[model samples]
Target: MDIAAIKEQLPIREVLQHYNLYPDKQNRLRCPFHDDSTPSLQVYYKTQTAYCFSSNCATHGKSMDVIDFIMYLEKCSKHEAIEKAKTLIGGDNQLQRLTRQAVLTKMFSYFKNAVYNSKPAQEYLQARCIDYRQTEVGYNAGQFHHGTRKDEALIKSCIEHGLLNDVGNKSRTGDTAYNVFGKWCIVFALKDSSNHVSGLYFRSTLNNQDQRHFYLKDRSGLYPKYPATDTKKLILTESIIDAATLLQIPAIASQYSVLALYGTNGFTQEHQAAIQSLTQLEEIIFWLNADQPGAEATSKHAIALQSLYTKARISCVKMPQGEDINSMAQAHDNMDVFIDLLEQRTADFSFSIEKENNNAGEQQEKAKLFIERGAPKQPTKTPPPITTGELDSTNPYKLRYERDTVNYYIQGGLPKTTDNMKIMLVIEDKASTQKARNRIDLYEDKQVEKLCKEAGEKLSLPAATLQADLYRLTDLLEQLIEKQLQQARPPEQALPVLTAKEREALQQFASKPKLIKRLNELLGKAGIVGEERNRIFLLIIAISHKTADTLHALIQG
Candidate 1:
């Protein structure tokens, strides 16, 4: 096939319209390619392409590519896609070659005559609350006779405008038959910016059973007419009624040119290009329905305009809840408030860091709980308590006990138990409680001094404090375990190396009580309360020795 001929025969505008590839200035349509929470997919008439820049999906392509993309989305073949495209375009592929000018001329003559002569068509427009006089067309009730007695002046005008052609025969019901029939239509000339007729729109009477009323016929390659000055702003709405309603708004009329899409689904690349071609527009306001689809389409169209002209300001004119522009205009005599609503529009894009943080925090909490419930079991054992007089200066038990008590108190634990232990030492021995307390205090103060010096080199003040407390607790516990090993004297002959389980139990008896108590006190200071603190402490105890060792290695590292 000749590519040039195919391109010429295939109207790009019509193809885009067929695939619903019009810029949704209102951001209303869900992107067909992916599950998008917002409409970021932009369709443009100037470039004849659609693209999505939002993070949701990467869809960008020409009109034909859009169809192919839709096919992929539907999981269908190209042939099937074309068939669907044909249905959407509202015509078969063969009809594309037919001269639209010829069709318009023939159809208009028939419709103009019917509108002037038929009582039913007149009543239909009136019943729908449409004022036919504003269209500047003549209407005569006597021109619709079935035979030769038909009004000659109406017939002559119809023929001259190329709005009628003689069919072979009259209907048996006695109505005059014609090659083109517009029994229920209101025909009008659609002009361009140059005030020349470019197309004809045949709108059917309101009472017709078929809701499909409007038909467009291009006059050669002429552009659609818009009633805006080169430098003025323009407001685009979805329907003719909406356009008229908006025009009646004094503020909108004073500041902008208004036009309608004619229907919700009437958007086409030709229409988009025509609007964009207006070089004088500083901004374009999309006055669309305030529903989901309308909002989505508005955003898409806004993106398209932004892509074309970096400086172009796009805004949306939102309608009141459950009310369209036409209805709202009829209800209120003033348009100032409506225009104010448009001026106050805001950009519709945002990111939520708080939401992300909440999600991550919830996941961490869940994992912690799961580990607590699924931890492996361990055994426990008891050790001999140290006597007052036997607690010699070089005895490891005495040194370890004093060190552990001081470590616990410095790490935010209560000093009650450690004070009691010191008092018991003084009463049972000749040593003074104050002297023993001062000794333990001096030892803890020296350890803290060393920790603070190390932490100061590595962290900020708050972080350093936290590090010092953790380090002090760990060092005291390790010293206590060493003391337990010396005092236990497991058989003295070293008969056999202790099993991993026995070794772990011995280590626990040496260090577990003090560590658990310190951890519980730290939890309380951190605002953990009641059953929660108890649960967390129990969970720590239930952890396997191997797991605890791994955790300790991590913390120390």
Candidate 2:
């Protein structure tokens, strides 16, 4: 885990709220570390930091961020505090249950009753050729109530889950606490691999075209709820209506399992996890819309599915232009067209092979052109991606930043990202030809120090030099990180040129008695004066703001 990133993203306000402490209107709160008559701790929201001014406080005058505050409140170490912060931020992979199971069961039951009673909802389902009789579905009349006094726990759970909205309002009891889904909307239960309802998805039956679909907050579920492990074929669709249509068809429903994505870009991690559990799966057919977005999604999802299930045949059925499965089904009134489309289904492998062949032909043409230009044709040797100075060099303890390792021989040198900087630390005893290996994170000082100490006792090199070289290598890594951030910026722009008047104004400002005067003195000693010096001074100031704090400034100007 990157502790720095956690500290950066977790807010101090969240930490205080977690502890049941609220800050007053002035953003001042009583310091919990010591007894106080009034609010004394100041919360700096901009910096996500808090400090207590009360002298009697144990944490007085200490700038406590979320992580530091967690440590103090939990009475735990920094590492423990960081782990707790991760849980609080929901950063880790553990899937958090958003609502209670009982509440959802009761809510689904209510919605089911609403579905059965509403004539418009049944007609809407019939119009779409959706046979939801065998499947779990619901309808929202926008009049859901969380029950009476005996079910207070369930009511509170409903409120927390957002199934019951606008509580404690002045509206009548029947008018209050409406579900997010407005009147005449169909609700579908989405489930995890274990067949447990994890979330709710809704389709608006109203005439609001812009707001046709809605899902519960933090929706983390997939439609159809479950696919048996023995199922060998899986068909993926773009929407629940399309999937439901296919499921209503006896031929497709018996032969294959149908799953629907929320939309083009709505393939969640939960969907991937569910697919991964299908050990018997052999084919994944993307039956999305025939539009550009659907085509793009098919290619994208096919590639991802290919990576996950390499042996599974990845194919796509091309629908008629601008027509999805539901529309096609509605137009044909049968499965004949769909069956023909399935028969004409194209495999992604053919496209991939054709692409590679075209690329190869293009490369050959380029090579022919190069030869025709009289450029010397010679076989070139490529370096083995990475090299270690400590391993291959005669000076085993060489302090080369780019290719250096201290006492440890890295298998993959260093990770490019700071989050994955853990490396395998290997040391060898030349006398016995024996080796010792341990994995350690370079960012963790304690781990590096321990590795160095062990290496010193095991190898002929000194531990201090080894530790110093590792530190120096990390410094170079900071410099090397520009390559990672370079792509994040647009094409670099040329330095802005200052006008004569602007230059004169800058010079006059820098010549005044302050920190800027030091820059002016340095430029004066170099005998560089006028517009060029002003540009250099401005450039120095701009760059220094990125790396230096208020107390420190780069004095190169």
Candidate 3:
């Protein structure tokens, strides 16, 4: 049998995808034979050849055929790797199907339940303007460890079902799942072209957005799409939540089919096959995130799929810069903004890949055609915390903004549109006391005034208007933060770590009760109280080998 003939039958692009590898602008992958972050490996689309260019790599700047990649990844002899490659000739392997079924039945259930029971989870959805009832997405109560014995057991069960790694009980120790999915997250279900749920996707709600998304360990290239949709128009976005948001809009309901890629960088051969299967499709609209990566991915996807769907008109809808469909929908409270984005397109900027040079030249042409359209304009509303980089950072102070979307439900007296308001929280240590304690004094009058002043200036509001909104927002934050403070702990994570000198000072004061009492009084005078002040006092006591003056200086530092 001809090895070349067998290799020719394999779709090299798809094969690379199995290892979660994708081509960059140059149609190149990171060499699998080395620890490479950059695209050190080049895959020539025209010649159907690949090579690792990094001279230091194990591949040693040598060229390779697809079979060599199979051998490298599978850790098998050339003939064995060839035989193994033959079995992957079809789509959605057996393990992928079995694990997907198990995860769907078990993992999705936990998250779907979490939507109703968890406050942070619910707040996260509300903040995105997503009513849990409006979508099929799943939620996880971010405080998975702190919950009851039942919660711990449920998470462990995920390991049993192969939803998580086979690391046993360690998967419950907060690091295992959080390492893969991030602190707290919501899971989105992925479906096949037939629209059957076959995999789970995760998006962190606890500000770990960089960890962004995760797939079932055994993903079968099954993605999520509304199976009921075949409206001749399909909108593709970066996430399932965005897709669900589009479908929820009355103006958009049933008008177009919607689906989400895992993200801008995420694409697979199965997705390409699904796109190719749409002979009846008349339009494919790209509705990606309003960021640089999203735009580039949209351009590439549109250009690639356009060739396969020759009969369809492919266009990319513009999300306002820094605003995704979730934020855009929440801002407009309807489909007007989405329709605006779709209507803004004037031409087919798709690039045709010339047969002569299918690598750099084709990509450069694609970029050239797409970039000519110009950048997305700045959005009108206050961008989400995730977009502004506020939520993504470590908020040791637990500083964040909370909003009360006043009109979530359409009751007899309520309007259909949600009255979304943004309120800034001003609490240095509200973590230890969100409830049962008076918190109004914790917020300074000047601080509240300053926040309102900024908001008013940004929106060009009259003083009187600002005052009225300010009163509402202040009262809302007071109520919201006060309620949540009940659940807040001492915030041990927020306290600063002691330096070597500080440790020495603390060691000196450890044996002196009188010194500890005096330092506590000094800390109180400095306006530090509660858990933070106590922690500082303890730090001094633990390292009492230094004098009181030294300890005091260390504390001040």
Best by lDDT: 2
Better of 1 and 2 by TM-score: 2
Residues 144-201, model 2: lDDT tens digits: 5533322344445666876666544554744444445445689887776655567787
Off by over 4 Å in 2: 1-99, 146-151, 172-182, 348-557
Candidate lDDT (C-alpha), each? 0.48, 0.67, 0.57
Instruction: Tell me the TM-score of each prediction against the true structure.
Output: 0.36, 0.44, 0.45
- The candidate scoring highest on TM-score is 3
Q: Least lDDT summed over 10 consecutive residues: which range in candidate 3?
A: 406-415
lDDT of 3 by residue, 240-338 (tens): 778777877776665777766767866677666666666568887888887899878887787777667777877777643556777555544335656
Report the error of model 3 at residue 106, Å. 3.2
Question: What lDDT tens digits, residue by residue, belong to model 1 across residues 238-268?
Answer: 7665665565556766777776675555566
Give residue 376's lDDT in candidate 1 (0 to 100). 47
**CA shift at 150, candidate 1, in angstroms?**
7.0
**lDDT computed for candidate 1:** 0.48
Estimate candidate 3's alpha-carbon lDDT, on a 0 to 1 scale: 0.57
